[model samples]
Target: MKKMLVFSMLILVLILGACSKKEDASNHGSVNDGEAPSEFGSIDHGVDENKVGFNLTGGTIEEAANVPAEEKDLIIRSFDTYIHAFNNQDLDEYMSTLSEKPKSFNLDEEREYIESVFDEYELSREAKDITIVKFDEETGESQVFANLVTKMKQKSTGLETKRDGRQVTVFSKEGGDWKVNSVYYMEDQK
Candidate 1:
């Protein structure tokens, strides 16, 4: 009888051990176990569907803060408008936000850049957890950062592709308005 009891106890221990291992595997980087990572990885290619072009040369927050309040607001509003335009794929509205003559770069140049980015990264199917990294209200300039979640469509097996881990965007103020200046995409090593 004692031997049978010992055998039963051992069996129970093995079952518990197996269950715990499964639990740990599922718990790996989970919402309940810890802070949920941004879903940018699930998106198609981490492309900002609405992204146009960013000013890659804009400096740090201190420099952006030098912009006047009124100009800053205009810049922020312009950026917001640009985001909307890109998501909606409204070419006319997107163009309107840009400078009339394109002192630094022409509209065509901007469009080509945007197209290249989209073709390359191909931002996720949905956008979420958008956080503004730094916005200097005093300067009216801001660094807007957001996570884009992308996923592979099961139906499109032939078009398999990797996902973008995270995407960062910088906006700058020029000619009393804000425009997307640069987009930095971080890839997952794994």
Candidate 2:
């Protein structure tokens, strides 16, 4: 069961990552509303040390507090809804937190993958060190980094597995709402 879970997660990551790269490449030169392109690059890449921008990669509460109150509240609320809905296996509510035009994967692909997970396992996830690592108001994009602890139990065999990881969830504004655009997760090495 643990092996299967790990395999599934690995596949999910690869597929979504590839989709994101393809979408970004295709939309590289397009600017919205005749506005200049954002200085901040894609969140999938590592942060550059020299960039003159928010440098809150430490994942601390103090760092997160530097973000504007309204934006911070909305981002965190959306993230919380995402986790809670997934744990509860509420598909509609879970999908609500994701963007209609996601950078990582299409809505249907995400729905199918998540549905499979929901059908096979019961998941409980807790997030800590939630911090806003980056925010670009002009682009309406923000990257929230967090430490995640998850436990999953196979529905059929009752086998359980646990994992700890660091996750970066990039949120983008769509229709005046902050929705999850992409995610990058790295599991802790044991």
Best by lDDT: 2
Q: List the candidates' TM-scores in order.
A: 0.40, 0.68
Residue-level error in angstroms, candidate 2, position 110: 0.9
lDDT of 1 at 8: 100
User: Which RMSD values do the candidates have, in order?
Assistant: 14.8, 13.1
Worst 10 residues of 2 by lDDT: 33-42
Q: What are the lDDT figures for the candidates, one per model?
A: 0.49, 0.71
Per-residue alpha-carbon lDDT of model 1 for 1-190, expressed as tens digits? 9999999999999998986653444233334445343222111223433342232222232233344566545655665676566555455686676554432344675665555444444233444444455555554345554444454433324354645445555556565566655445545556
In candidate 2, which residue pairs get closer than 3 Å at backbone N, Cα or C atoms, i.e. clash? none
Tell me the lDDT of model 1 at 172: 60
Candidate 2 TM-score versus the reference = 0.68
Candidate 2 lDDT over residue span 1-190, tens digit each: 9999999999999998986543434233234223332211122333333331333343334344357899889888889998899889898999999888887556775777688788888888999988787788888988777788989899999999998876778899888789988766656678
Against the true structure, candidate 2 has what lDDT? 0.71
Displacement of the residue 60 alpha carbon in candidate 1, Å: 19
